[model samples]
Target chain A: MEIAKSLQQTPSSYIREILAAASDKNVISLAGGLPDEKTFPIDLMKPTLETLSEMPEVFQYGATAGYTPLLNFLTDYFQLPDTHIAMACTGSQQGLDLIARAYVNPGDKVVMEAPSYLGAMQVFGLVQADIVTVPQTEFGPDIEALRTVFYEQSPKMFYAVPDFHNPTGVCWSLETRKQVAALCEQYNVALIEDAPYRELRFSGEAIPLVSDFCPQHSIVLRSFSKIASPGLRVGIVSGKRSYLEPLIKIKQGADLHSSVPMQALLLGLLKHDNFDYHIDTIRTLYKSRYETLYSELQDKLPEGCEIKPVDGGMFVWVTLPSCDTFKLAKELLKDGVAVVPSPVFYPQPEAAKAALRLNFTNATPTELAEAVSRLASGLAKAI
Target chain B: MEIAKSLQQTPSSYIREILAAASDKNVISLAGGLPDEKTFPIDLMKPTLETLSEMPEVFQYGATAGYTPLLNFLTDYFQLPDTHIAMACTGSQQGLDLIARAYVNPGDKVVMEAPSYLGAMQVFGLVQADIVTVPQTEFGPDIEALRTVFYEQSPKMFYAVPDFHNPTGVCWSLETRKQVAALCEQYNVALIEDAPYRELRFSGEAIPLVSDFCPQHSIVLRSFSKIASPGLRVGIVSGKRSYLEPLIKIKQGADLHSSVPMQALLLGLLKHDNFDYHIDTIRTLYKSRYETLYSELQDKLPEGCEIKPVDGGMFVWVTLPSCDTFKLAKELLKDGVAVVPSPVFYPQPEAAKAALRLNFTNATPTELAEAVSRLASGLAKAI
Candidate 1:
């Protein structure tokens, strides 16, 4: 049977293919946006995992939205307004898929930074949305270009990762946050704020979410994978009840509900006394790795290669002289360093500039140094 | 913001509303298709739960298809052909949703029996599929009518639950299964075999799956929810690689994958030496409860109300003399026995026959007898 027209339009994921290639023992992979396996707070979660057998109710079917105890806790944990609510998903990726299915129509325009999260692009692409992009500046998406697109295209939504953005690790400045929120409210575009790396900050103090400025006009997606465990496959989506109810309706057909045991386990970990400290440990570990990679690159990168220091989050963006970054990445992979090329992150690959996203969280300091030596050698040969 | 046009056309699930109301302590609910909580094999899963912390790799991100070990285990467990492969989903429900998203385009014809699974209807509805229905008879679907529909409608697929079918506990006769498979092959309509209740049988000898006759032209959804636990939210979908590749693409955006820890736990339970004994225990327990409900209804249902004997499955359908079933269900709810009305199951509600679906699982034999007493008194007053 032929596949759906909508699905036919979505190119199969390139990251999945590259990740598979990078998994060979011969390569050191910084290609995936994965939290380190060692960072998972299993000791903090042990009490809940053991307690699950005693709580038989969680093993039964649960409410379509989420487990009540988790939902109630998140409402307070996030300090949600009276009109707002929280729903759990298998992961924040599913939350984005739900938002796309619930709100987007074929040909509906969706705005995103040019170099955006690959997973978000895939979700919106599956719905056949007309994805529009604005160039990214170090602060975030180019604000002027964003305003012009919103003013002219009247897009349905703007999807963004404001706190330590993926691919570039460019957190939106506070002024830009308020401005983007205001623009969304003015344009009647829903702001989808994905903060999977929000808690991974190592150097800078935290800032307010863009959604904080316009709560009614935005939805926030939170991930615990960085702090807890990705294998639990649980994430939270919060917004006003009106915005979330349709997601719940779609979710009923999606999975009935996410795993109740996972949700309950999440709630238990969030309530644990050591949970806050666990986040700090992940931050310090990632920070040390990030600094090691940064200093190594600063010492070794060739002429015309520029690298930006990230305050928090998994990756650092390296800008190279215009060249075939894909070719560069292929050579680098054979050189035994795995980094994602810039084009894969762009909705229109041809429109992307020459750059690469290198992750720091998954590799050890010594491996980070070795990978940079391979990266620098490959770049010198290409440029 | 307006919901997507497709979502707007889909009705909110009435089953969900009814199930919520049925949760009242005063109501003896026959509205939900829930397995008894006592059936969950927690003891069998305990050893695995304690071992999860040691296996740090399972806590990391997994392949989108599933955890490798679970997929390999299911491949042999299901005795799938060398050409076939298995993938995990949050539930069989998500697998169905993925199939619709991957295969059905807007306005594409999809076929089902008149009274079908509500979740299936919702998934198809979300895709804006043109759902065409054929009538169902005691043996399964009306074979002649199915052939006519297949020839005329040219539906992309026929979604079915051939064994101990939902709402009406009518297991398809072996002859009907063969006929349906032949017609599907002849007409080139893909057969989607959903077998959540296939293992719940208590008395009858096992029958070959409808898919077995048309493996190349079918996708099979097998649920562990009824046998292990629904809260795990893990199910298996198996078919040829070509048939399953599109679903994996859609599933990449759905949840990346289902909960890895849950999948691991399920594998452990399935491997346990006593797992088969646990299923036999559930079968025996449910069979006893089914006997009580069947006998009570057989003895006490008002005149003109016809109750069919079910070989197995969760529900028993009661055909009533022409009347308002929605109103009848409401009265039964007030009478302290909650049962689902028939119209909710129909794509074209007005065309449905007056009937009620009474569940035989979840409630005890004593409660089932009392529920029947209440149902009989209420029917007498109404009819």
Candidate 2:
């Protein structure tokens, strides 16, 4: 029948396509950014779930802002000022979605990194925003490109993954983070810093958050998906009241509130003394997987292919000379291995055809090596 | 700060305003449609939670379509056809919101029952849809009005709560249900039947769902919030594949999927033979509260005020002759009772000013009586 113009303009999730291709029982999936299920902290959560089940309020309707204790815990943990407001989201993706809803009008300009999180791009597209991309360099988004776009477009918001960006394992340099924040402030654009991978760092010193540089102009999204549990779908969006108040209002109609039992379970985990130890364990596990995948790709890939060095997060972005990653991805699937084509991440199609993203967190060390060898063979055929 | 045109046009949730006014603990709240916490199946869910906590898959990222077992269970429970597809939402509110996203373009016409669910109205407003209303008669939406709007406006969708409608507490006659389906099909408009209160019916025979009459042209939203647990936030939207597929695709960007552990716990409860018994207890509780409220209003209210007859569901719609319910509501609040003024539900403000909605399910029978006495006294002063 008649579909919304926004829905008509929006494309189905590219990640879902990759997921469908990787769903075969025999395939080794390095396409999805899923955390290792073996490290889900089930034993730790059993007692927490038991305690939560006894509380009737845990299963009753809760405040749309979120479970109070969890919000308090996040505010305290982040050391946010009293002027800042924090709300729980079903996931960080929802946090991004709400921000887009609160600020981006149809045909409004939204500036984002070229190879950014596909989910965020999908959200902007769904709202029918005119997305302008700034090419991302090794350290972060190209500051000059951002400045030029900001001056030319006066975009409504700038969305970035400052810490260990999705699809590309690139972390912003501390100077670049501050500069990006300063430029957004200069242009009066709201900044959305997506930090889902902040805690997954294996090496390199931590960069200060973009919000830390411009709290008044930035909204930071944090998630428990990588470190705690994804299935629970818990995340947070913290920002100044002017911006956050509208997002909270929109959130009420979005889902009323995130699930209360889910929030209580997260609150329980955050209250536990050994929560940091659990995060450390996760970091150690992913660090090993990252090393295995990176080294195997370097040793196995054909000559014209290049893998970027990554300090943290689930994915590694690889560039292949004279290759269409979408075609190569399909060819690789025939070899029983799956990786995401980079075109999904780019707003412009032409810039995305030569690169592919490989997630290192879901597969084992041995599986990573085998998947890479298979990918190399597939690449040879495609080239 | 540049805000979206849609958000600029949308008003904040009216329930939030009522909630803010009722935040004072001294006020007896008959305003919110919250389920009684005592009726929540806490003990029934304990064993379920224990089993879910032990399973790592419950905490891992789940299928965007939903947890398979839960989907299968719902399909069988509803006796849905093979051509129908079902997906889990964080809550049925989300199901409504996604439906709006999938179909209602900015400036597109939407036909809905007058004084419909405020939450649904807010969603359509957020998407900038042009909402056209059809007035409610004693039996259902005035079919003549609906037909006129359908032919004149050709609205994208018709949103209705056919069974024990919200705000009005009126169920459509079987003839009306079939008429709604036929009219929608005739005009090529999709029907969204929100059935959150279906299982909470305490009296009267259940009318067949609208989808039963026109399977391909209708989508049904069902929730566990009222009958099971609102805190768990579980719900489903089932419809023909064409409509459902787009909703699922949009759902991926709207929180990915409903929480898996929450769905698993629901599945566990469904598997238990006594699940219907839990729902029966909820119905019995509400039935008592509704009777207490209706009887008290009839005894205490001034001659000009009238309470509609309600067979089941949580609310009773009260119409006051030549008076502002908003002013009456404020006076009642001063007397320590809270109710939702009806203007929030109506698309046209003037139409809503003479009515108010009282929720019968949240407070005890004694509390309901006390609240009604206070409301009647306040009305006496206002008139």
Candidate 3:
């Protein structure tokens, strides 16, 4: 069978396959950046199911912009006008795909953060865009490098995870975000600020989106997958009317709309008194697990190894000196533990082969400790 | 604001806007091709939602293919082997979009039925494909015309809704389907068999999909949105392993996956004894309403006006004599009646202006009568 030439060249998601293989076991899997299912407000959702069942059309076809009530809820929650918001399914990945479709023509230039979410990189690749990854410093991306890249590529958009950045878990500082926003404004480039983990702040005050600087040019994406239920496949896109209206049109062509029942249920949960209370509880739960894993890695890992403790979100990023982390990850999986190989997160695979992302949210405290111990042992053996 | 250049050309869904505008007390909208909400198994979904709430992780990020249980249920229901299945959100529109992304290169040659589903045409158009629509005869698309077009264009794919086709509400005869399938096989052309209205058979024996003739080269899409709840956003795609695999990859990039809670709830509903009973109940309900519509139009419509009494599905495709449907539709809107101008369904906008699509599913029998009377009055006055 002659497959699509593009698909023939496309690589299947390695993380997706490994996650599926580990699902049936007690594999201490930290590979997938999934929120702990124990924290998803199922009790609140239980009543929500019943409430939405009363209006069956709520379980039927909805506007492509997503369910109106949920969009309204998100607009109010994000402090954006109703015109600035549109919702999507599949966490923030669908939002990324929409951005790719609406903005990037073939061979168009796009700038992304080094070690950003693997899925976003894949989206850029699928659109056949020329992607330049600007290196991130301790707090955020290097602004000077961005300026050089902008001059070289004349990129149309910069895709960034400003809050609790994926794979690396570094949030942009308020000043850095403003700086980048100003640069984008200077270059007239769009900023795709993905903040799927914005609300899971275990520490630090929440910063307003980069959209604050140039509302018309900045597109911000937030997802329920981290704070609530990823299985619901709900995410919100907020930007100025100029960017959002085009996105809504692209969304209609893409999926007609997101799931109506899921949006209705999410709206019900949001309206419930216990919604914020449950998110607070989840924050505390993940905070302890993250702290436990961070300490374990710091103590057990080799002296030259570095670990970045995430302020929020599910992951803890680790870098090892002179070790094949991907090989070590496979060895750890053999020991019934799994950590995502960080090479998958990069535009060029060889650049990030020595790093790994360990998710602390889904595992229990003991499991998190045991998983890190296994990784430590595997790293020692591999080195 | 410098918007992405790609969006500058992508046409907005004209039908979707009309659907939104018609949501009022006076508007009798026939614009949306929606399955009747009253006929859906809404009550049965109550327990399914309750059961889903118990599994919190079901609300978390799901497998890229879809929820496993739903996939398994759909596989068994469709009687297809595991190798040939994929799941999509909302309906098969997403499936079509994913297929377009995976297979279509810019400026590719594609083929379509003369007046196929506008949504599918919208997708092909977005990919910048040159589409040739074979004229539809009473039986189906003209077989000889298809052969000529297929040979001339050597299209990337032939998109057709053979099972109770959309807009026209015409099902291709099994003989025509086989002839088309055999021709596709001979020419090495891929076929997309979109069959949302398959089980909505008002009469006549069910025809097995054309894919059964050339499964290796065809993608068959079915949806629960028509027979069940569109709000859940569940649909099934089945074809050769070679075709399905690429579609699955596209699915991964498109939305990670559909909602797990919705998928699980749907799987639970499929397990019930009342599942087929509910489908039959829908068939009976729609059949009666369709008859009422056909009789009313026949009685009230002016001489020389043509209306097709469809065997299945939710719409009645009408072609008025010597009247501009675009203008008449606006006039009808003023008189509290609405219909979609059928020219929008055609690939070439200049092909027809006298046709319109009236939906029978959403309106009640009494409401249908009033709507049709208004349509008659609108037509009589306009013509």
Candidate 4:
């Protein structure tokens, strides 16, 4: 039977495919953007689950927006006005789906940064949005390129990972964020700020949300998948309540609500003083992992291959010298190393290629050093 | 900001809106179709959570198709032949949304039972499908009416809650299900069987699924929100591998996966020897609740009102004599009683005006009797 035309339009996510294909018993994967399992707050989670179990409401269907306490905590955490937060089931990916369903119409233009989060691109493609990829400089999305795309496409919305972006672990500069916000206001484009990695910053001070820059037109999304636990599938969206109203309605029709027990656990965690302490520990762990991976790549990778330090977040983006990342990745998988090619990050094939996203978060420091060494040796032979 | 015209076309769910409005502290809620909290299988669930917590994989990002063991259990439970099953987050509501997004293109013709599940109606409406409701009879959907709709609309699919139907509380006789399956096969239409309440049957042997009759063209959905735990948000969709393939793709883009921890807990419960014993206990309890509700309604309902016994499910479908149930519900709520107007059950307005769905499962026998008594007295005074 023919699948729906809309799904036919959505290319299966390459990261998912590559990850699945690389599931060999031998492969050490840096391909998937998975948070290191060790970073999960197991000690705290054990106690939190005990507390959640005591509250029977935690195991029942919750409010469509979120579990009441989680929403309240998020509102306070984001320091948004009261009642401006909503929780989502799964990752922030569900947030993307809800936003697209709530606001986007078929054939509407959607401006996204080139080499963006593959999942967001997949969601936009499913919505049948005409995708326009704005160029990206090392600092984040290129402000001038964003302006051109906004002017040319007059897009309904612009999607970005302003804080420690996916695939390329570069946060948008504070000035660039204001410029983009100003352009969005000028062009009447809605801004979808996905900040899943916002809390993972190791050294940088927090940048004020673009929602502060463009309050009416912005929605900022956050997820526990990064710092807390992805297994619980809890995410939050905060913004102007006006923009959130439609999203709530969409969420109501999607799932009655996110899991109440998960939300309760998250709420319990957020309420504790240790939440900040946990995030700090995670930041330090990720930073050490990043250093180990970066050093190993520097030592082992052949000349002409280049790597850059990630300001924050779990990934280290690498560009191999004149090599097909996908083919090299496949060959490396045979030799027990797996990495996601960079081309899959773009909305369309015509954009660019020749890089790979290596996640340092999921691997141990020793494993990271070994994987990078193995990948370099594999690439040398394959090239 | 104006929501997209597409979302505009989808009507807000009548059940959700009424339930939200019925949140007044004084109002007795017969409005929501929620199951009794007392039957939450807390004993079983405690063990499930303990087992799940011990499993390290429970706190990780799972495969999009869902936890493998749960899928295996569901495939066995559904008695499908080599079918693929995927888990949905929150509840079966997300499953419906996935199906809508995966298949129902704009203006696609859909055939649904009149007075259908309001949640399904709302999702289909959002997909912009041309919805045509087939009249529901006491035995099942009106077969002749369905044939007529099929002839007229050439619908892409038919949606039904055959066993212990929603709002109406009527089960399609086995013969009727067989006939509907034949017709769907003849017309080349897919059948979406929503069986959240199937296992909740108070009496009678379980009817074989619509998929048993037409596996190739059927999708059978099940939910733990009803039997296991709503707050944990676990649901499954099982069908031929062919269709399930696309649905999995849709779900992947939608939520990535259901909560791994929740799935692990559910799988543990299902594997435990006490699982069936727990179901038996719930069934016995709900049976008593149903009897109490039926007897109370008979004793207290206004003269011309009728209440019928439902073989299974959480609801008692009541038809009031010549009174508008919506207005009567409001009057009853003022008297500290609440009921959902039956009109919301229908895909369109007219079918629901004179009826209301009273949930017998969610409340204790004493509470059910008292609510019914209040409703009877309020009905006498209102009309």
iRMSD per prediction, in order? 0.6, 1.0, 2.0, 1.5
What is each candidate's fraction of native interface contacts (fnat)?
Answer: 0.89, 0.82, 0.75, 0.62
Query: Deviation in angstroms for B33 in model 2?
Result: 0.5
Listed models, DockQ each:
0.91, 0.82, 0.66, 0.67
Better of 1 and 4 by lDDT: 1
Q: B1-383 in candidate 2: lDDT tens per residue? A: 76778888886566677778887888899898889889888778888888876688878889888999999999999999999989999899999999998887778888888889988988999988899998999889999999999998888889999888888899888999889889988998988999988887888887799879988899999998987898888889999999988888788887888799999998988888788888888888888888899899989999888877877888899888877777777888889999988888987768664888899888888888889888888888888
Candidate 1 docking band: high
Q: Candidate 4 chain A: minimum summed lDDT over ten consecutive residues — where?
A: A81-90
Note each model's CA RMSD in angstroms: 0.8, 1.4, 2.1, 2.1
Per-residue lDDT of A117-219 in model 4, one digit per residue for the tens?
8889888888888888888888778888888888877889999888888888888888888898999899999899998988889866888877688877888
Per-residue lDDT tens digits for candidate 3, residues A268-330, read 888889888998999999899999999999889976678976788778888877666667777
lDDT (C-alpha) at residue B374 in model 4: 88
Off by over 4 Å in 1: none
Quality of candidate 3's docking, in CAPRI categories? Answer: medium
Best by DockQ: 1
Model 4, B86-134: lDDT tens digits are 5554578888888888888888888888788888888888888888888
Clashing residue pair totals per candidate (backbone < 3 A): 1, 0, 7, 8
How well is each residue in B109-186 modelled by candidate 1, as lDDT tens digits? 999998998889999999999999999999999999999999888999999999888878989999999999999999
